[model samples]
Target: MRWVFLVLIVLNALYFVWEQQQPSVHVQQLPSVLNPAGVANIEVANATNSQTKTLDSVQAKINLTLLLGGFSDPALIDSLSQRLLSLDIDVKEVVVEEVDGVDYWVYMPPLVSRSVAVRQLKELKARQIQAYLINQGDMQNGISLSMLDTMDMAKDLVQKLANLGYTAEIKEVERKQKTYWLAVNSRSERLIDESLMTELTSDFPLMRYRQEMPQ
Candidate 1:
């Protein structure tokens, strides 16, 4: 009986030593908050901050203001304002005025000419053809010619008018005291014997005709 007990104790000791030498298997627990389909919240926050910084830098480069006047269309004003703002410009003011029976929009920065503005208004009006005279003092009038130089321009205009069934002639050319005067003879085939000379004279107020002595 004593010998059988010793052999059983030795077998138990060997099993315990084998179990301690064997490699153990471990199962890892995954985080419950992780989702494969969705983007991480931290990554989204970083991207938003980067985009905002880029927009702010782009806005700093542009600096121009415009003041619009005489334009009453809220839709037009809003569209124009938004477009300019998108380009990072500032609109300072807008004013509308009615002077001498004509509506006028005075715009600051003056991107457009008075004639162009008048034409736009007329198109909006959708009736009678509107004539506009731009105030030369308000804007730069580019490259004007003297009377001698104007004669060349006038000659071209007169020739073109003559080709379109109108009778026109440069009746006299006088170089007096270092100045030249051109007498223009104008008659219209369409309005025969019906004070065409008077009409021409009124149309060209700056021109003077040569007087003819009676024979």
Candidate 2:
């Protein structure tokens, strides 16, 4: 009876080994740990990475201020700002500053003879163009076509004079000048160029970014 029990035990062991080695006997796959706890940890890690990227992007952006110059009149500054605003620069970003500086003027040719000057004034009157007579001192024979409050006005006046068969030009002088400034907050300094602000102010050759434009 003991021998028979031993033989049966050996047979059971052999059967178990054969089953494990058989190609058809596949191992059962276990379920993955995708419970609320695991998902929560994944979400936390994603959130952390997103926050880090935001901080790095913020740090990369810089704030700069540009000072637009070459304007002696507030009208010119206003015009420039309006043009910039049309180019998508916010109106709030533009500001006018009054500072001590020199101004320019547009003047017609000085008549060599007083009689010719008077006759020219009469012609201008007939054409409905209002002009000032330089009725004093060495410039007495000169005709003041326009007093420049802005370069645009000066140019326009000159063009008007040209249309009327009169030659005109701008004259540089001295007085208080108005300046325009633009404050920019951007991811790149190149954004200013991309915004087309530079092209708009190109006529104002002196326009530039100030060392202390932050104020």
- lDDT for each candidate structure: 0.42, 0.68
lDDT score, candidate 2 = 0.68
Worst 10 residues of 2 by lDDT: 182-191
Q: Give me the overall lDDT of model 1.
A: 0.42
Any residue pairs clashing in model 2, and if so which? none
> Residue-wise lDDT of candidate 2 within 1-215, one digit each (tens)?
99999999999999999999978867998777667888899999999999999987665443334454445555666676676566565533455555575555877667888888888888998899887778878778778876666777788888888988998779876565445555543423344574465576566565665533354
Q: Give the clashing residue pairs of candidate 1, or none.
A: 68-94, 68-95, 69-95, 70-95, 70-96
Predictions: Cα RMSD each:
28.0, 18.6
TM-score of each: 0.23, 0.35
Candidate 2 displacement at residue 204 in angstroms: 34
